[model samples]
Target: MTIQILSLRKKDLDKIIEIENESFVNSWTINDYINEMTHNPFAYYLKLIDKDSQEIMGFVGFYIMFEHAEISKIAIAKKYRGYKLSKLLLTDVIKRISLANCENITLEVRVSNIVAINLYQKLGFEIINTRKKYYPDGEDAYLMNKNLREED
Candidate 1:
């Protein structure tokens, strides 16, 4: 199955929300996505779709300001996990950000999400710091950063 990465559209939100709700304990609402897509100048969202089936496999959201980018969220459909699709999606995001002249990228991941932390680390993101009680449920988060210029 060929997967195509494309910009997130209003029509894609239902599937995106389905994946998001299943993937996270606290998921963003439709309104939250709408605001990001419509009102946030710095925000960029992308969705991966099966070219043959047209199924939404996963989605990622991020914001770019000046030379910095921060990943806000990323999720794969329940059936799509363990396929390294997240890595593929994020690698694409990094490439796009680099092409846009971003100097660095950062993201906050729950400390308990070892799988995601591993993936980020493999992608060259280093743990720069920790955020205490960063989540609504008071979970701590690890702040990871990757310097795009260093990869060059």
Candidate 2:
């Protein structure tokens, strides 16, 4: 199973939205993706593409403004779960932002997502704050950060 992580293109929107809707209860629509891809200069999007099937298995999105990079969303296909694909997607995103000279990367995860929390922590992100009821379903979120500029 070869998965290629590539910079996302407009043609991938339908596939990206497919995975997004499958993973999240509230997913971004195709139009939303189009608007972001076309209009947002700071936005970075990447996809995990299955080489054989030519399918998009997952995607990660973030926005870099000034010295900060905020991970907007990430999700893998339902059939692709338990394969550690999301971690690969996010890790690549972080690497790309760091190579582009971004100083900070941040994301907000649902407080109940212990798996994601552990993954982020293992990748060197630290919790900086929390937002009460940040999700539409009243789920709380932990605001996390990984500083690219300072190793220690």
Candidate 3:
């Protein structure tokens, strides 16, 4: 399947919500996504689309504040999970942030999420800390970070 990365559009919210619900236990509300995509100056949300079918395969969202950025969300459709789509979306996000001169990027993953943690680690992220009860369901989170300067 041919895949293309595009900016998130207002019309894509419903599909994105569906993917989010499948991907996370504490999924974001529609208003939360709307606020970020429509009004947040620092945020940039992107979608990975299947070019031929026009279906959303995955998405990644982030916010850049001066020199630092935080990945807010990332998810692939349930059927698309094993294809490394999350890795592709993350790679795109890193490239976009680097072009914007971001110095650091960080994200939180559930402590029990080994697959995600391994992906981040493979992409050069380091486990920097842990947030107590970071998730709505009281799951602790591992805070991972990648500093752009280290790669250079």
lDDT-superior candidate, 1 or 2: 1
**What value of lDDT does candidate 3 attain over all alpha carbons?**
0.91
The TM-score values for the models, in the order shown, are 0.98, 0.92, 0.96
Clashing pairs in 2: none
Rank the candidate models, highest TM-score first. 1, 3, 2
Local accuracy of candidate 1 as per-residue lDDT tens digits, 2-69 = 99999999998888889989999998889999998999999999999999999999999999998999
Worst lDDT run of 10 residues, candidate 1, spans 11-20
Q: Between 1 and 3, whose TM-score is larger? A: 1
Candidate 3 Cα deviation (angstroms), residue 26 = 1.1
lDDT of each: 0.94, 0.88, 0.91
Clashing pairs in 1: none
The list of candidate 3 runs beyond 4 A from truth reads none
lDDT of 3 at 151: 71
Model 2: per-residue Cα lDDT at residue 64: 91
Best by TM-score: 1
**Which of the predicted structures, 2 or 3, would earn the higher TM-score when compared with the native?**
3
| Per-residue lDDT value at 132 in model 1 | 100
Alpha carbon lDDT at 42, candidate 1: 97
**Per-residue lDDT of candidate 2, residues 31-146 (tens digit):** 89889989999997888898999898888889999888999988888998878888888888888889878899999999998988988998999999999999999999999999
